[model samples]
Target: MNAFLQEVLTPGSIVQLATLASLIASVNFGVVGTYVVARRITYIAAAIAHSVLAGIGFAVFARAHFGWDWCAPVLGAIVAAVISAIIIGYVSLYLREREDTIISVVWAVGMSAGLLFLYYSPGFNGNLESFLVGSILYIAPADLWIMGALGLVVVLLCLFFYNPLMAVCFDEEFARLRGVNVPLYYMLLLILTSLSVVLLVQLAGIVLAIALIVLPAAAGLHATGKLWHAMCLATVLAMIQSTLGIAWSYTVEIPAGPAIILLSAASYLAVFGWKWWQSLRAASSLPIRS
Candidate 1:
């Protein structure tokens, strides 16, 4: 712990970047994650996260073969994530019958395609593990700028469409009856979720990205009834989890992503268990009736 603090206190250390990245990423996690949990679209978000590897792989392949140095992996991840979100949204909205099967196919095919592309990309691909599992401590300054910009855009969009999104999330039929363009808002939510997934992927990698997105929001939802309150609490929880995860990972010489996720999962379970106990106590305290 002391060593971790010392590193954090050091002038211009990578730990500083890691801490900042987690804090910035938490905003999207809390905001979009609230919508995802409310709408029960964690599956869709998971599909988008895994599918991002396709874009990343293709970006690497293109950069190697076509000499497109501008197409960075993160850029590819954003493009692929948005496209996956659209496809998944369309299926959920219009092709309701085969939604699960189609989403599953997308998830599997995306991963397969990514592996194939990476295999044929003709390079060392040293950061492949980091891409798959995450390496938050090694993030570049450029990555921080990109993440911050994306996070700002996500927060602003959520603020702008708060009412319609809340309606769509809780009661789509009612929202449609009220002329809210449910489909459009639903798609918009999915896009925002995709962007959030991308940010989480940078911190936790594709394999654990869904956990980071859902756990904090789940804990927040359990802690509060209102949507905005849940968002606020979830963001705070995510920041704390991220900070602790970074510190724990440093102290234990483990990976930051999994460490962070463990803390998030523990917090969620603790909240859930506490809520359950309270419910049981309330039930026990109820007046007996014949």
Candidate 2:
């Protein structure tokens, strides 16, 4: 265990990359995740994440055929996530009818299209596996830089617009009455959420990234009363899970994303069980309301 820690904590190793990636992801998750849970928009995050695969697949295909040096898969993912966010946001925020159906369609089409693109991308689509299931253990330095920049942006946005965001999350009608630009802020939240999902693609992949963003926040919110407090707790929990997952991955020689997600799942269940037990005890202790 000590040796594993040393290797991962080394200045620049795969384990170190995973650690850094987790930190970056935790920050974004903490901020955007708060809004996601508060607004009851966890589905939006899942949609953006799953839809991002289409962008990645397109980027890979474009690079192969058109040699668009700038069309990195990550870039494609961001574009796709943002676009999908806009569409989904518009539907949920305005259309309001059949929103779930639309989102479900987007989720399926995006993934299906992505797979088709990957099928034809030139030689060795093995790299695509990382986008599917995450490859934090093999994260590139460039990706880390992207994660850092995005993390900073998420923090700054949250700090600057905290109240407005909270207003929108808690009650859109009330926020609108208060001149909070509900529609604009709503879209902004979705965009930010998409960015969070994109950063997580390398950490947890399209299929499982939602867990990293949603689970920690869910646990934190269940334990805290304030949004900021929940966000902080969520960040800490995410760090713990990511670190433990990476270490365990090293020991068991398994995929880091799955390992991390499994730990998160276990923690969530524990928290859930504790909460249930506490509620039961409280009910038993309460005066019988004959």
Q: Residues 1-290, candidate 2, lDDT per residue (tens digit)?
A: 78788987688887888888898888887778878987888988898899999999999899988988799889999999999999998898888987999899889999999988988887444676788899888788888998999889978998799999998888889999987899899899999999999998879899899988888888888888899999998888888998899889988899989999999888878888898999999999999878
Highest lDDT scorer: 1
Assess each prediction's global lDDT (C-alpha) against the native.
0.92, 0.88
> Candidate 1, 64: how far from true, in Å?
0.8
Q: Per-residue lDDT of 175-268 in model 1, one digit per residue for the tens?
A: 9999899999999999999998999999999999999999999999998999999999999999999999999999988999999999999999
- Model 2 Cα shift for residue 237 (angstroms): 0.4
Candidate 2 clashes between residue pairs 3 or more apart in a chain or in different chains:
none
Per model, state how many residue pairs clash.
0, 0
Q: Over all chains combined, what TM-score does candidate 1 have?
A: 0.96
Error (Å) of candidate 1 at residue 181 is 1.5
**What residue pairs are clashing in model 1?**
none
